[model samples]
Target: MIDQSLIDLWHGFGVAFQFHNLMWSFFGVLVGNLIGVLPGMGAMSAMSMLLPLTYVMNPVSAILMLAGIFYGSQYGGAIGAILLNLPCHPPHAVTCIDGYPLTKRGKGGTALGITMISSFFAASVGIIVMIFASPLLVQIAFKFGPAELFSIMLVGLIAGGTMSRGAPIKGVSMTVLGLILGMVGTDVNSGVQRFTFGFPDLADNLEIVALALGLFGVAEFLLNVNRMGAVGSNMKLGMKDMRPSRAELKTAFWPMVRGTLMGMLFGAMPGTGPTITTFLSYSVEKKISKNPRSFGTGNIAGVAAPEAASHSKTQVDFIPTMSLGIPGDPVMALILGALLIQGIQPGPQLITEHADIFWGLIASFWIGNILLIILNVPLIGVWVKMLRVPYKYLFPLAMVFICVGVFTTQNSLFRVGEVAVFGILGAILLLLKFPVSPILLGYVLGPMLEENFRRALLISDGSLQVFVATPISATFIGISCLLILLQLLFWLRNLMRARKVRESAGVPT
Candidate 1:
């Protein structure tokens, strides 16, 4: 299989570098980055909006363009999150927890450099895995029944619950709150309207862009309104500022490796996307760190891990999308539609039947990634120059962009209003010392988690044992339990130490 893939890849490089195809890849990557930079603009939106233009091209060129749009956007999303404390995409929300803080410390260029390096490394790892292990990953994804999927999501939620610095319960409660808010849309099973109090727009569920922007962007806007001068005060854009130190590079290496592996796994799965993988990466980095408390602060590892994971996941998304012909989400659905329109069938025989198309797309990944590296590095200076602009003037421009971006999501004023509401909610949570990110994780994962959980139960005739019935599911469940146990032990040890200190001090015991 490996030998055959090598032959196919060589042939693919031939087809992908055809002048027109190569140009499209560059164009796609450039457009993708632009889409990512704009708040609320996703690759799905960009592709859908631009897909009409692709209809005139041959199928392979179209696929290459769309594929570039899909993953290349991730490269730019980190820039917004790290530079402006605005997460243009949900996966980028995790980047903000540390990436933004690094920017605040005049390390924005270094952080961006790290994000680019980590993203490229992880994406290369993912692409290599796809080349070598696409078949294996597709099989693994099939093994994940709804029960396994539910178990994995549970692990993510549990890990996210413990992600905050001082307050696990606060994180957990925010997660629950997010889950509850996630339930606001109509229940898919019963078609019953939920939490949407006579407003028709709620039936489709909360927009992730609105929720994320509200929490990170608008909430920060409100909190820092008084301290406007402090925002981006440290954005010094020297050549040296853009490069990571030896110590920082060393710290980032392992997390990037771990995140790349995690991203590869999640990316290959149909239902589990970049958002979950990035969230899990953040948690894993925090867990493995000697000083976990430094995570929410400006830890370079935090930036490295999740950025690697998100970009890696984006690259790996190609596996299931191309191999299984399964569109894990709406973005891939469009690609699948493009395939059908091109009169190509998607199945296990995809690579064998359409070697040119498959191989060409793979080759485009390599080219697109190269293009992105060339495209983004110079932009670092431009983004840094923007930082020289004062926050007071900058934020209003951000607000206009946010409003325009959200409004474009569904062409509704209602969505823009939703951002304001969530902004207020996020502000309240922030002011009260609750970590708002777990809520976004819950909100992002909740609906999918509930759907899979219900589907798993339904498959087992409502038997709860189904979750642990399979070895795969059981292993995931065990991992989740182990993580919880570790957290419990940590908490208990802290409790005991605190009690001893209080007793010795003669305070109320």
Candidate 2:
């Protein structure tokens, strides 16, 4: 089986390396990278905008380019996070925790180097997993029904509650707020208008692009506009500084491996895209680190882990979408739509029937990652140079980009207005020491949670026992309960320890 797979893969290389196909792949990644660097723009929007072009192109090359764009944008998102502290994509948002601090300390180049290395390593692993394990992974994914998916999302939300830099309660509060915001728009089940508040523009849910850009990009600009002059003026990086030292590489290596494992685990599961995987990777690193306090203080592992997870998840996300005709996220959904337009059906037979599209795409993953490395690595100096622009000029230009990008998502001015409102809310969260990351996580998973739970109830005729009847659903619920219990124990330990400290200092309780 392995031998035949290798032969087919070699043939796939032939198809992918054809001049026109290669150029399309290059153009896709090039555009994707640019979109990733800009705030408010998302891979879904870029793919959506270019989706029409696929109608006139070869189906094989069309998918190759679109797939390239999807993952290429992921690579570009880290650049914005590392340099400007703007998480152009939610998955890379965790990178800003350490990446921007590295920039402040004149280590932006080293951070970018680590990000590139981790990304390449993780992508390679994910591609290999996709090649060998697609059949088995698809089986596991099939076991997940609405109940199982809902339970797992519950676990994700609980885990997300731990993502904040300040008090866990603050993180939980922000996550709940995100859930509330996610409720804006019409409910799918009843077709009733929700938090839309009589606005026709919000008949659909709030655009995630607007929410993410507002919270991270516009909010950062608002809070820092006064201090922008001194922010990057002292940043000095050269080619020499871009290379990671032995110690830094050593620190990042294990985290990269751990993160890749996490990505591979979650990537094959539909609806759990790179964003949750990245957050989970960051949380795991913080939990296992010898000094967790150093996580937000430019720890190399903090950057390496999440970037690796995001890229790995991005690569493996192709598994279910292509193999089982189930998209892992909205971006994959768009790609699936493109395939349908080409009169191709995706399923188990796709490999035997559409061999060229499947294998050629696998081969293009190698080419696209190589192209991204070439574009991002040698150009680190150029990316870092953007920071040197005076704050007076940069912030306004970024806002313009933000507005334009948000508007492009659906061509609605109302979405741009949504960005402004979230920007003010984000600034308030920052001032109050609330973690904004969880809010995005909650928003991403909230609707999924609601849909799956209601679907499960409907399927079981309002019986709650269906949630635990399946092994997968029950296992996830067990994990969620364990997480909550552990959190309670941790809080108890802290409260008791605080009393001891007070007693030692002879202070009143």
Query: Best lDDT goes to which candidate?
Result: 2
Predicted candidate 2 versus true structure: per-residue lDDT over 35-105, tens digit per residue: 88876676877898999999999999999999989989988899899889888887887898889888888
The TM-score measured for candidate 1 stands at 0.97
**Residues 301-412, model 1: lDDT tens digits:** 9999999888788778878887787776677788889888888988889988999898898888888988998887777777777767666887788888889888887889
Candidate 2 local Cα displacement, residue 388, angstroms: 0.7
Angstrom error at residue 451, model 2: 1.5
